[model samples]
Target: MTQFDAGTEFDRQVRTLIEKGFGELAGLSADAYADLLAPLRATVTDRAAGMEAPTEGRVPFVLVITRELAPIERAVPLLTLGGRKRKPGIIDRHYAEGDLVRFVPAKEVELPDARAYVLFDVDRGEEFCGAIPNDAMATIAGRGRTPLTMEEGIALVTQYPAALAKNKCFSLGGSRCGDRRVPAIWISENAPKLGWCWAGNPHTWLGMASAADRAGSLG
Candidate 1:
């Protein structure tokens, strides 16, 4: 697989956010938001410099803005199906953002404290397809990888809609609700939908998503 150019990917993410009006949501003008991300560009460039792009598997890195800056409610609606409008991503009515706090990162998955950060070597966990969520989590940990969080999941789909393929969708196993409900992103009504699945259950079409690590400065 050809590796994505880090700088180009970074620029694309910035443009996506601006075009999606994330700056306005953050209470800043588009120009101001771009300016805010300027410093991070240098950091990403430096980190990616001299690194060989992977020939297969995950991309180099993905830029992610936390819920504090880009709320999920707003970000989800921005997602489209195959670059066309189908149905906006919806958070199941049974839960709300306040309940999101209960879903913390799984063990070995450390997130950055900054409002924006980069998720390195993200995998949609295709290998774990057909595996139960609980079992999948163990397998991911055994592989010395970290599962993707809900924010990171949204970030991944936001940047790469192709990742949410029909039969190869993924679950955000990193964010556990202290119950059986594991958050997931899958195709529904020919659109991307954010919903929950029981941890004990398994779906042949869904695997757990993960990443190698994360990095960012406190911005």
Candidate 2:
């Protein structure tokens, strides 16, 4: 029932990840360590707090996945409607392996092949890779104008049952926003309690602990 600051939660997660994964700096002076950590924290904190949704699909969420944990590549069951009969097809979407996935609005697509044809089947309500024989990029544009509210964000996470069922997301409770602690949750894949990571932010870099037990306490 209290307000909460997202940045604080983000800081704690970054610190924990560093400590657990990097261990104590054996040779560095205290000041040196402090110096080293300051920028790391600032860089990560700002990225999470200031993350913007993508501009293209305007997809309301971005799933930031850590590099250490590669996305689980499994085909999701997709029903494609055409030819007077619905056909079952499999589409590839990156699912988090074991780290919290940060959610941002869809701004652009980082396609594996820049020249590949993208397809959007309005009749089927599905988007997938296609052999359209054209270089035009297909996108699900014209959506996600309103900024997401806290409630709406939470709801967005619940929609991905596969991610949640795997315990890929977590919730944080009792963080001071302004004067009170509020309940907060991050439902992105492998999301830590704070829901952002340096591994996946800025650029996909390596060296971060996996999200196996990084759920953190409800506080």
Candidate 3:
């Protein structure tokens, strides 16, 4: 089986996301990778490679991330625990219309709407993207969203049409999360045989061209 390190996969994902959703830079560089990794977790295990497990009930949802440029570290932050702080691995792209993906950082409870508590719910895992549950594994960064409750989160979801419409969460080997009708990927020149994914509407802010671009990008 062919195996690229978690960092490399992360680099490809970030580049694809930024390239399709926002940035136009050539791709991620060593310096830029380091910059993105400053506060996130970079596990030494295969979890960085996309093998993950189900972590639903644990308070504070964990998103175990890789630096993508460097193998020396990983990013594990807890977004569901309730705090107002945004961890480094997480980024708020912008306030664009219908472009606010729930994965982007926001205090869902701050709004008066109680039913807006829905988040894109990216899985909290480690060792690999699809690894089974391991009790000893380290949790992602702790409690960055401690300031809110579930009721408010639901309300925000109802109020923010953009975020709700764009809230397409993903999980490898998990159930399909996005609109099935939407085309889902980009062909990577670096790894041409392995077509890459560009995913979701909010993620479309990057440079992902549908009309002019090819259909290989898995958006």
Best by TM-score: 1
lDDT of 3 at 95: 20
Across 34-61, the per-residue lDDT of candidate 1 in tens digits comes to 8877767766787786545632235667
lDDT of candidate 1 at residue 198, scale 0 to 100: 94
Candidate 2, superposed: residue stretches over 4 Å from native:
15-40, 43-63, 68-107, 110-140, 144-219
Clashes of 3: 61
TM-score of predicted model 3?
0.22
Candidate 1 worst ten-residue window by lDDT: 50-59
Worst 10 residues of 2 by lDDT: 115-124
What is candidate 2's lDDT per residue for 1-219, written digit by digit as tens? 333443454344334323322213224444444444343344333334433332221222222212222111111111122233333222212223432223322233222211111111101111211212011012212231122212222222222222221222222211112322122232222231223222112211111111111111111
RMSD (Å) of each candidate, 1 decimal: 2.7, 19.1, 18.5
Question: Global lDDT for candidate 2?
Answer: 0.24
lDDT of 3 by residue, 1-219 (tens): 445354454444344333321221224554564354333224322234343321221111121221121111111111111133222222122323342221222222122111111122232122222222111111222223221111222212112212211112211211112322111111122110101122222232111110000011111
Show model 3 residue runs off by greater than 4 Å.
1-4, 24-34, 37-219
Cα-based lDDT for every prediction? 0.80, 0.24, 0.23
